[model samples]
Target chain A: MIQKILYNFKKYKFLLQQLVSRDFKVKYKRSVLGILWSLLYPILMMAVLAIVFTNVFKFSTPGVNYLVYLIIGLVIFNYFSEASNLAMSSIVSNFSLINKVYMPKYVFPLSKCLFVGINFLLTLIPLYVVIIVSGTELNIYHLLLPYVFICLFMFTLGMGLLLATISVFLRDMFYIYGIIQTMWLYLTPVMYDISMIPENFQTLFKLNPLYQFINFARSIILYKNIPTIGQWAGCGVSAVVVLIFGIYIFRKKQDKFIYYV
Target chain B: MKKETMIKINDVSMRFNLGIEKEFSLKQWFVNIFNPRKFKKEKQEFWALKNINFEIKTGEVIGFIGSNGAGKSTLLKIVAGVMKPTKGSIETYGNICPMIELGAGFDMQLTARENIYLNGAILGYSKDLLDSKFDEIIAFSELEEFLDVPVQNFSSGMIARLAFSIATIVDPEILIVDEILAVGDIAFQAKSEAKMMEMITGGTTVLYVSHSLEAIKKLCSKVVWLEKGNIKEIGNTKDICDKYENYTIKHMAGNYDI
Candidate 1:
């Protein structure tokens, strides 16, 4: 299976470049300001939320500056949402390619994840600036950011591949995706900080691994503290399980996917 | 004797279920899950093709003629590997190119040049090969000025011209063409026909499916007539085509005009 994927990757080299390039171009094509929109997204969201909740309206984001903390979690959650929301529909949208050729089928979602990944990387520059301007001290704990990001990636990819396969066989998946995507935003503790939850509920809420990821990222970037070893292990274990199950189901279901598509 | 063999499919069969008789709903899903057949499930499993076997030699053009849903495209798709046969094996030694569904690689959102590179790669062209052949493809497609524009803007004829141009470039040992060539203009169609002839003369195998019996007569050396998922006739193109025509005339009560 790995050899098959590798061979297809080599065979479709030109196609990969074209797809990535097309994605880049189509994103910025018609806008008067072009790719400036990329910078505008997180920055604008951070500012608007910061103003409404903290500095202007005094809605309170706890001890951290509403702008900085929200921006941190927003950047991470955006990556997951962007990857998953589009990933669910990746195979369905690209029926043009799926209908004709026999590809690995996992590549479409992975390619889309890469597209959002590029955006994530782009969003990081401003995130670092926010980190600096917030006057937060950096330490060895900050070095672990890459590990947290990988967990986020694997967790999202697991779900993305699962949703792609399920949606292929079931049209009801589309309706379900809309509801799930909406609820998932709140589930991840994106717009609101996790501390708002009562202490009794922390264990229950953190049981959802996605919130654990957001909390882990926030603890490191905002508080300059790494997650406890137990939390990290939990996130890691969940990530591994989700990805393994996701791939297993995707490969098994993919043989019939062309017919469904 | 050195016999030229292009493609071989042995005892291929395909069956599909049309699914439940009623529209699937959440309640129905749960009910059916428990009962396994709570809804009026139609046992609509039918073989679209059964025990289909054929072999075409190098430089031979084979025409597949059948009524609607005769499993022609399904058989072609199996040969293309776009689909796998349920119960048989299909083997081809050379580069197999299938045009069973024209513009399968095309995305209207991308420009023609972008699509050409993308589509060509999907069809198994190496980068260097496509780079050199790029100009030739554009010239064949006659879309030099419109190359930068998204393909959704192109007419179906333009799409057909580009697809055919790319399809022929494979120099495939086995080439599969559906009824897509009929989309282009008369002049372009003539040009396409010339391209197919050149491929045939160069010892490539061509398997064609077309409603135009006239073109089939002109191009194919062998004709396979299929009816209800089985081969009705397989022999010299002229002989079977003639008999098939007479049978069709009989089906239409002899009202057809010459």
Candidate 2:
């Protein structure tokens, strides 16, 4: 099964590229600022959150720049949230193609991943600039950023596929997903400090995949420290487990998707 | 000389659940799982196609004639490998290019030029191949001026023309077309018909479904007349089409005044 997917990947690589590219193009279409909004949107949100948290709420990060800290979490959280949202609609939105063509079903959800991944990668540019301008130190540990990205990507892909499949049968999945996403955002320490959580409860918070990824990412970019091997393993394991389960369910249910959609 | 079988369908059936109210969330599903009686009255199973069996030899131009809701599209979708049959199976040799719906894979926000690549990839054409055929597809569609404009701006007829051009660019071994030629302008329709004839003459097996009886008679060698999800008649085109015309006329005699 894996081999067949890889073979189809090679054969349909261009289709995937075009599908992902179309998403990026349509997202910025007719906007005056165009692709700049992908960067600026997160920066603006971070600024608002930074002010509200640091001044209004009296929250502060002693060593790390609060703006940088909030923005990293926003970018990562935004990608996962946006990617899953798109994936939920991916199958139904392309019902015309599904009704006519014989391409692999996973391509639809996977393309959503690629679309969000591109935006995530592009958003990193502004994050990098902020890190440099703020006098944050860069070290070899920053190379481990890609590993964190892979974890988040896999988790998103799996979650997206699962949602995409369910959404085909039940169109309300997206609305339900929207509420879950809002809940998930608050649960993750996107704007708040993780250390503020009681020490014993921190382990429960650490179990959130986004928490693991964001912590590992901030450790590299802001703290100039490599994540402990346990953190790396936690992210990798979470990604693999979610991805395998997603693919399994998606492949199992995809044929029925034609009728349900 | 004997022709080899290109497509084989054996006892294929498609069943759809009709009345089970869809649950939007796990909470609803869990609640309904205990009390399934709410939707029990509406619980119905409809067979879209029933025990369908057919075989097409290589180089055969077969036409599927059926009224709306007669499962013609369902059968073609099964042949295209997009939908799985509830019962039985189908086996086919060679790559299938299904123009089941014009511009099925097109992105409205992308230019016609960009859509060529997008649609071509959905049809399983490699990027390099699409690149090589890009100019040919554009020229055939006659949308040179609008190549840079997003397809959302194109008229439905223009989209159909573009779709037809891209689909016909390659000489597919098997082509499944379903009522697609009806959408474009008459001139492009005639031109696309000519291109289809050219493909047929080139020995490509074509499975076409259209409401136009004239087209079916002109193009098909063998015709399968389906009614209510079952094959009513399968024979030479002239014989079945004549029967179908007479049947419809006789059946609708007093229902409508001409």
Candidate 3:
């Protein structure tokens, strides 16, 4: 499987670049703010969530700034959701090219992930500005951001691939996924902290992939500490398992995707 | 001297499942899971292509002529590697430019200049290659003034011109065209025909599908006539065109003749 993916990557490298750029171009085309929307989305979500949780709910953490904490979780969660959502529809949306041309099926979903990945990274500029302006101390621990991000990216891609395959057979998956994401957001402790969860359920909550990823990010960015070895293992294991499952499901179903599309 | 085979098809067949009562909605799929007999699925099938066998020599210009739903496009798709046949296999050498769905790579919101690179990349051209050929592509398309304009604003003919320009930029080993010229204007058609003639002279193997019998007779050395997912005739262009024209006239008049 790895060999096949590597071979396809070598052959379709140009195609992948073009696809990712095309996504960026189409997304920003005719829009005045262009990529500013990427930063705006998370910031706006942070504002609303911060006001609600800090004021009405009166939620507080001992050491971390609530805004920084919420932004970190929201940005990471938004990346996962947006990337997977776009990738989910990648196959269905590219039916025109799929019906007429022959290329690797995975490139579609992978390109969407890369596209959203770029947007996610770009939005972090604003995220960092907020973090630094809030007088948070920078340290070497923050350098491990890529480690946490890679975990989130792989996990999103895995879900995206699975969703892309299933969406081909059932067109309703795009809408169904929206509902799932909303519920998933509430479950991931994005708006509320992990402290809100009862002691018995905390372990159960950690089982959620995004929960582990968010915790990883919070450890590095907010707490200025690296995640434990177990946390790293959990993130890596879930990512690889889902990615392998995704590739397996995609390869199994891809031959029939053209027919349904 | 022996001619090298560019494409080899041995007993290729395409089967399509059709007229099945599929659950188009999630709610329907769920309900049907409980009540399996509620919607009876009639499993009707169609043989889009049946036991197709052919070989094309390098530098040969071949034309596939048939009526609608005669499996002409299906055969092209198989050769282009767009769709897999249910039976048998096709072996093709070198790069193939499938001009069947021209402008399939274009994002309508993007400008023509951007789309040229995008479409060129899809056709397996590198970024540097596209960059170098950008001016040539624009000149061929004659859409220089509209370069900055998005494709959505362009007419269908303009889009076709752009697509044709990018596709024909590099002479491909195998060129698969399927009635794409039907969309563009007469001037662009004449220009494209001239370009195609140049490719033919340059030893590009061509597998073309078009309703224009005149073009096929003029350009193709060989012709394959298909009817109802089966090859009816394969011979020199003149003979097949003559027989196909007669067959069409007869079939139109309710006479079962070939």
Best by DockQ: 2
lDDT of each candidate versus the true structure: 0.78, 0.86, 0.86
Residues B132-230, candidate 1: write the lDDT tens digits: 899999999899999999888999899888887776777677878886354499999888877766765566678889888998898888999988889
Question: Each predicted complex: what DockQ?
Answer: 0.45, 0.66, 0.62
lDDT of 1 by residue, A100-211 (tens): 7655567778777778888898898888888788887667887887887888788888889999888776767878888887787776676676678898987777787777
Ranking of all candidate structures by their lDDT, best first = 2, 3, 1
True contacts kept of each: 0.43, 0.80, 0.66
Instruction: List residue ranges in candidate 2 displaced over 4 A.
Output: B20-35, B180-186, B254-258
- Candidate 3, pairs of clashing residues: none
> How does model 2 score on DockQ?
0.66
| Candidate 1 deviant stretches above 4 angstroms | A56-63, A191-200, A226-228, B1-6, B19-40, B55-59, B180-183, B254-258
What docking grade does candidate 1 earn?
acceptable
Cα-lDDT of candidate 3: 0.86
Residue pair clashes in candidate 2: none
Query: What is the descending DockQ order?
Result: 2, 3, 1
Model 1, residue B89: distance off in Å is 3.6
